[model samples]
Target: MSRYVVSFMKDVLGGNGRQIEVCQKTLEIDASSEGEATELAKQKFCKVEHLCEWSLHADRIQIKSADFTS
Candidate 1:
Protein backbone atom coordinates (compact mmCIF):
# COMPACT_ATOMS: atom_id res chain seq x y z
CA MET A 1 0.00 0.00 0.00
CA SER A 2 1.21 3.47 -0.94
CA ARG A 3 -0.05 7.01 -1.11
CA TYR A 4 -0.32 8.97 -4.35
CA VAL A 5 -1.00 12.44 -5.54
CA VAL A 6 -3.25 12.88 -8.56
CA SER A 7 -3.28 16.23 -10.27
CA PHE A 8 -5.40 17.25 -13.22
CA MET A 9 -7.19 20.19 -14.86
CA LYS A 10 -10.70 20.37 -16.14
CA ASP A 11 -13.49 22.76 -17.03
CA VAL A 12 -16.08 23.38 -14.42
CA LEU A 13 -19.32 25.33 -14.47
CA GLY A 14 -18.58 28.99 -14.59
CA GLY A 15 -19.04 32.15 -16.59
CA ASN A 16 -17.51 32.85 -20.02
CA GLY A 17 -17.79 29.46 -21.69
CA ARG A 18 -15.49 26.88 -20.10
CA GLN A 19 -13.01 27.80 -17.41
CA ILE A 20 -9.79 25.95 -16.97
CA GLU A 21 -9.14 24.58 -13.52
CA VAL A 22 -6.68 22.51 -11.54
CA CYS A 23 -7.22 19.77 -9.00
CA GLN A 24 -4.58 18.17 -6.80
CA LYS A 25 -5.31 15.71 -4.09
CA THR A 26 -3.80 12.86 -2.16
CA LEU A 27 -5.14 9.34 -1.97
CA GLU A 28 -4.17 6.29 0.09
CA ILE A 29 -4.35 3.14 -1.96
CA ASP A 30 -3.27 -0.45 -1.93
CA ALA A 31 -2.77 -2.65 -4.95
CA SER A 32 -0.72 -5.46 -6.41
CA SER A 33 0.70 -3.26 -9.14
CA GLU A 34 0.88 0.19 -10.66
CA GLY A 35 -1.83 -0.75 -13.12
CA GLU A 36 -4.23 -1.14 -10.22
CA ALA A 37 -3.30 2.28 -8.92
CA THR A 38 -3.99 3.83 -12.31
CA GLU A 39 -7.32 2.11 -12.52
CA LEU A 40 -8.27 3.23 -9.02
CA ALA A 41 -7.42 6.80 -9.77
CA LYS A 42 -9.38 6.69 -13.03
CA GLN A 43 -12.40 5.32 -11.27
CA LYS A 44 -12.20 7.92 -8.52
CA PHE A 45 -11.65 11.03 -10.58
CA CYS A 46 -12.96 9.84 -13.93
CA LYS A 47 -10.78 12.45 -15.70
CA VAL A 48 -7.40 12.37 -14.09
CA GLU A 49 -4.41 13.54 -16.13
CA HIS A 50 -1.52 12.38 -13.97
CA LEU A 51 -1.29 9.94 -11.11
CA CYS A 52 2.07 9.56 -9.42
CA GLU A 53 3.33 7.83 -6.32
CA TRP A 54 3.62 10.10 -3.31
CA SER A 55 5.10 10.06 0.13
CA LEU A 56 3.01 10.89 3.13
CA HIS A 57 4.60 13.35 5.50
CA ALA A 58 2.53 14.17 8.57
CA ASP A 59 -0.69 14.71 6.63
CA ARG A 60 0.30 16.21 3.32
CA ILE A 61 1.88 15.08 0.09
CA GLN A 62 3.88 17.66 -1.81
CA ILE A 63 2.67 18.24 -5.33
CA LYS A 64 5.37 17.72 -7.92
CA SER A 65 3.93 18.74 -11.31
CA ALA A 66 0.42 19.97 -11.91
CA ASP A 67 0.84 21.86 -15.16
CA PHE A 68 0.36 19.01 -17.63
CA THR A 69 -3.29 19.78 -18.24
CA SER A 70 -5.07 23.02 -18.94
Candidate 2:
Protein backbone atom coordinates (compact mmCIF):
# COMPACT_ATOMS: atom_id res chain seq x y z
CA MET A 1 0.00 0.00 0.00
CA SER A 2 1.04 3.55 -0.67
CA ARG A 3 0.13 6.71 1.21
CA TYR A 4 -1.70 9.40 -0.69
CA VAL A 5 -2.91 12.90 0.01
CA VAL A 6 -6.38 13.71 -1.13
CA SER A 7 -7.43 17.31 -1.24
CA PHE A 8 -10.91 18.61 -1.82
CA MET A 9 -11.03 21.99 -3.50
CA LYS A 10 -13.68 24.49 -4.45
CA ASP A 11 -13.56 27.52 -6.70
CA VAL A 12 -14.55 30.85 -5.26
CA LEU A 13 -14.06 34.53 -5.92
CA GLY A 14 -10.98 35.96 -4.28
CA GLY A 15 -10.53 39.41 -2.73
CA ASN A 16 -9.06 40.58 -6.01
CA GLY A 17 -12.25 39.52 -7.85
CA ARG A 18 -10.53 36.59 -9.47
CA GLN A 19 -11.58 32.98 -9.28
CA ILE A 20 -9.31 30.85 -7.15
CA GLU A 21 -9.24 27.29 -5.98
CA VAL A 22 -9.55 26.84 -2.25
CA CYS A 23 -8.84 23.67 -0.36
CA GLN A 24 -11.78 22.65 1.77
CA LYS A 25 -10.38 19.49 3.27
CA THR A 26 -7.48 17.09 3.04
CA LEU A 27 -7.20 13.40 3.90
CA GLU A 28 -4.43 10.86 3.99
CA ILE A 29 -5.27 7.45 2.59
CA ASP A 30 -3.45 4.21 1.92
CA ALA A 31 -4.23 2.26 -1.20
CA SER A 32 -2.67 0.22 -3.95
CA SER A 33 -2.80 2.90 -6.62
CA GLU A 34 -3.80 6.51 -7.13
CA GLY A 35 -7.18 5.48 -8.51
CA GLU A 36 -7.95 3.35 -5.51
CA ALA A 37 -6.84 6.07 -3.15
CA THR A 38 -9.07 8.59 -4.89
CA GLU A 39 -12.16 6.40 -4.60
CA LEU A 40 -11.49 5.60 -0.98
CA ALA A 41 -10.90 9.22 -0.14
CA LYS A 42 -14.06 10.34 -1.88
CA GLN A 43 -16.17 7.87 0.05
CA LYS A 44 -14.60 8.77 3.34
CA PHE A 45 -14.78 12.50 2.68
CA CYS A 46 -18.45 12.40 1.72
CA LYS A 47 -19.33 10.31 4.74
CA VAL A 48 -17.42 12.55 7.09
CA GLU A 49 -18.95 15.73 5.65
CA HIS A 50 -22.46 14.21 5.63
CA LEU A 51 -22.90 14.65 1.89
CA CYS A 52 -24.54 12.28 -0.56
CA GLU A 53 -21.77 12.85 -3.05
CA TRP A 54 -18.28 14.30 -3.08
CA SER A 55 -19.12 16.85 -5.75
CA LEU A 56 -21.95 18.21 -3.60
CA HIS A 57 -19.38 19.93 -1.42
CA ALA A 58 -16.17 20.06 -3.45
CA ASP A 59 -15.71 21.28 -7.01
CA ARG A 60 -12.75 18.99 -7.63
CA ILE A 61 -10.54 16.40 -5.94
CA GLN A 62 -6.74 16.13 -6.04
CA ILE A 63 -4.70 13.03 -5.34
CA LYS A 64 -0.95 12.77 -4.89
CA SER A 65 1.48 10.30 -3.54
CA ALA A 66 2.65 11.05 -0.02
CA ASP A 67 5.75 8.91 -0.06
CA PHE A 68 9.00 10.85 0.28
CA THR A 69 12.64 9.86 -0.02
CA SER A 70 15.94 11.51 0.55
Candidate 3:
Protein backbone atom coordinates (compact mmCIF):
# COMPACT_ATOMS: atom_id res chain seq x y z
CA MET A 1 0.00 0.00 0.00
CA SER A 2 1.06 3.54 -0.66
CA ARG A 3 0.36 6.73 1.22
CA TYR A 4 -1.79 9.34 -0.47
CA VAL A 5 -3.10 12.77 0.23
CA VAL A 6 -6.68 13.43 -0.62
CA SER A 7 -7.61 17.05 -0.80
CA PHE A 8 -11.16 17.95 0.08
CA MET A 9 -12.41 21.35 -1.00
CA LYS A 10 -15.39 23.64 -0.79
CA ASP A 11 -16.26 25.51 -3.96
CA VAL A 12 -15.75 29.21 -3.60
CA LEU A 13 -16.79 30.77 -6.87
CA GLY A 14 -15.35 34.18 -7.37
CA GLY A 15 -15.98 36.70 -10.12
CA ASN A 16 -15.56 35.83 -13.82
CA GLY A 17 -15.99 32.12 -13.49
CA ARG A 18 -12.98 31.65 -11.31
CA GLN A 19 -13.17 28.98 -8.65
CA ILE A 20 -11.69 29.66 -5.26
CA GLU A 21 -11.28 27.49 -2.24
CA VAL A 22 -11.93 28.86 1.19
CA CYS A 23 -12.10 25.53 2.95
CA GLN A 24 -9.95 22.48 2.52
CA LYS A 25 -8.83 19.39 4.39
CA THR A 26 -6.18 16.85 3.52
CA LEU A 27 -6.41 13.26 4.58
CA GLU A 28 -3.54 10.82 4.59
CA ILE A 29 -4.54 7.33 3.66
CA ASP A 30 -2.95 4.05 2.75
CA ALA A 31 -4.40 2.12 -0.14
CA SER A 32 -3.32 -0.25 -2.85
CA SER A 33 -4.30 2.18 -5.58
CA GLU A 34 -5.32 5.79 -6.10
CA GLY A 35 -8.91 4.81 -6.80
CA GLU A 36 -9.23 3.01 -3.50
CA ALA A 37 -7.65 5.88 -1.63
CA THR A 38 -10.01 8.34 -3.27
CA GLU A 39 -13.00 6.31 -2.22
CA LEU A 40 -11.82 6.01 1.34
CA ALA A 41 -11.11 9.69 1.51
CA LYS A 42 -14.55 10.53 0.23
CA GLN A 43 -16.08 8.44 2.93
CA LYS A 44 -14.00 10.18 5.54
CA PHE A 45 -14.87 13.55 4.09
CA CYS A 46 -18.57 12.92 4.40
CA LYS A 47 -18.34 11.88 8.01
CA VAL A 48 -16.07 14.73 9.02
CA GLU A 49 -17.72 17.51 7.04
CA HIS A 50 -21.13 16.87 8.56
CA LEU A 51 -19.83 17.47 12.06
CA CYS A 52 -19.33 21.15 11.30
CA GLU A 53 -22.07 23.78 11.55
CA TRP A 54 -21.81 24.89 7.94
CA SER A 55 -24.20 23.51 5.37
CA LEU A 56 -22.04 21.89 2.69
CA HIS A 57 -24.06 20.46 -0.11
CA ALA A 58 -22.68 17.57 -2.12
CA ASP A 59 -22.24 19.82 -5.14
CA ARG A 60 -20.22 22.32 -3.14
CA ILE A 61 -17.91 19.73 -1.74
CA GLN A 62 -15.53 17.71 -3.87
CA ILE A 63 -12.31 15.84 -3.87
CA LYS A 64 -10.13 18.24 -5.79
CA SER A 65 -7.32 15.77 -6.26
CA ALA A 66 -5.65 12.74 -4.83
CA ASP A 67 -1.91 12.34 -4.98
CA PHE A 68 0.17 9.36 -4.06
CA THR A 69 3.00 10.52 -1.83
CA SER A 70 4.60 7.22 -1.04
Candidate 4:
Protein backbone atom coordinates (compact mmCIF):
# COMPACT_ATOMS: atom_id res chain seq x y z
CA MET A 1 0.00 0.00 0.00
CA SER A 2 1.06 3.54 -0.71
CA ARG A 3 -0.21 7.11 -0.92
CA TYR A 4 -0.77 9.16 -4.05
CA VAL A 5 -1.43 12.77 -4.87
CA VAL A 6 -4.15 13.65 -7.34
CA SER A 7 -3.93 17.03 -9.00
CA PHE A 8 -6.94 18.76 -10.53
CA MET A 9 -7.26 21.49 -13.15
CA LYS A 10 -10.60 23.01 -14.05
CA ASP A 11 -12.37 26.17 -15.00
CA VAL A 12 -12.81 28.61 -12.17
CA LEU A 13 -16.40 29.23 -11.18
CA GLY A 14 -17.81 32.71 -10.49
CA GLY A 15 -14.97 34.41 -12.27
CA ASN A 16 -15.13 37.21 -14.76
CA GLY A 17 -12.38 35.83 -16.97
CA ARG A 18 -11.95 32.36 -18.38
CA GLN A 19 -9.38 31.08 -15.93
CA ILE A 20 -8.48 27.63 -14.74
CA GLU A 21 -7.66 26.69 -11.17
CA VAL A 22 -5.46 23.85 -10.07
CA CYS A 23 -6.14 21.86 -6.89
CA GLN A 24 -4.38 18.93 -5.31
CA LYS A 25 -5.34 16.14 -2.89
CA THR A 26 -3.62 13.12 -1.43
CA LEU A 27 -5.02 9.62 -1.13
CA GLU A 28 -3.56 6.67 0.73
CA ILE A 29 -4.11 3.55 -1.29
CA ASP A 30 -3.26 -0.12 -1.36
CA ALA A 31 -0.78 -0.51 -4.26
CA SER A 32 -1.42 -4.21 -4.18
CA SER A 33 -3.21 -3.61 -7.49
CA GLU A 34 -3.74 -0.64 -9.77
CA GLY A 35 -7.50 -1.14 -9.88
CA GLU A 36 -7.82 -0.92 -6.10
CA ALA A 37 -5.92 2.34 -5.97
CA THR A 38 -7.89 3.87 -8.81
CA GLU A 39 -11.20 2.83 -7.28
CA LEU A 40 -10.24 4.14 -3.88
CA ALA A 41 -9.24 7.49 -5.30
CA LYS A 42 -12.43 7.83 -7.32
CA GLN A 43 -14.61 6.93 -4.35
CA LYS A 44 -12.90 9.46 -2.13
CA PHE A 45 -12.69 12.48 -4.43
CA CYS A 46 -14.87 11.99 -7.49
CA LYS A 47 -18.06 13.42 -5.96
CA VAL A 48 -17.11 16.97 -6.89
CA GLU A 49 -17.12 18.12 -10.51
CA HIS A 50 -13.66 19.68 -10.30
CA LEU A 51 -12.07 16.80 -8.45
CA CYS A 52 -13.27 14.33 -11.04
CA GLU A 53 -10.70 15.78 -13.45
CA TRP A 54 -7.82 14.90 -11.17
CA SER A 55 -4.82 12.90 -12.28
CA LEU A 56 -2.59 10.86 -9.99
CA HIS A 57 0.99 11.92 -9.53
CA ALA A 58 3.69 10.35 -7.37
CA ASP A 59 2.82 8.04 -4.50
CA ARG A 60 3.39 9.17 -0.91
CA ILE A 61 3.92 7.64 2.52
CA GLN A 62 1.37 5.01 3.45
CA ILE A 63 -1.60 5.57 5.75
CA LYS A 64 -4.44 3.34 6.86
CA SER A 65 -7.31 3.17 4.36
CA ALA A 66 -10.64 4.61 5.45
CA ASP A 67 -14.27 4.49 4.31
CA PHE A 68 -14.12 8.21 3.66
CA THR A 69 -11.56 10.90 4.45
CA SER A 70 -12.87 14.41 3.99
Each model's lDDT:
0.43, 0.94, 0.64, 0.48
Which lDDT tens digits does candidate 4 get at residues 1-70?
A: 5554433333454466665553445555556555666666666665543454334422232334344556
Best by TM-score: 2
TM-score for each candidate, following the candidate numbering = 0.33, 0.90, 0.58, 0.38
- Select the stronger candidate by lDDT from 1 and 4: 4
- State the TM-score for model 4: 0.38
Off by over 4 Å in 2: none
Compose the digit string of candidate 1's lDDT tens values, residues 1-70.
Answer: 5444444333355676765453445444455455565556555543342323322112222323222345
lDDT of 3 by residue, 1-70 (tens): 7777766656677887898775567778788887888778777776887643324533333333345356
Give the C-alpha miss distance for residue 18 in model 2, angstroms.
1.7
RMSD of each candidate relative to the true structure: 12.3, 1.2, 5.0, 8.9
lDDT minimum window of 10 residues, candidate 3: 57-66
* Cα lDDT over the full model 3: 0.64
Candidate 1 ranges beyond 4 A from true positions: 11-21, 24-26, 47-70
The best-first sequence of candidates by lDDT reads 2, 3, 4, 1
Off by over 4 Å in 4: 13-16, 46-70
Candidate 1: 10-residue stretch with minimal lDDT:
54-63
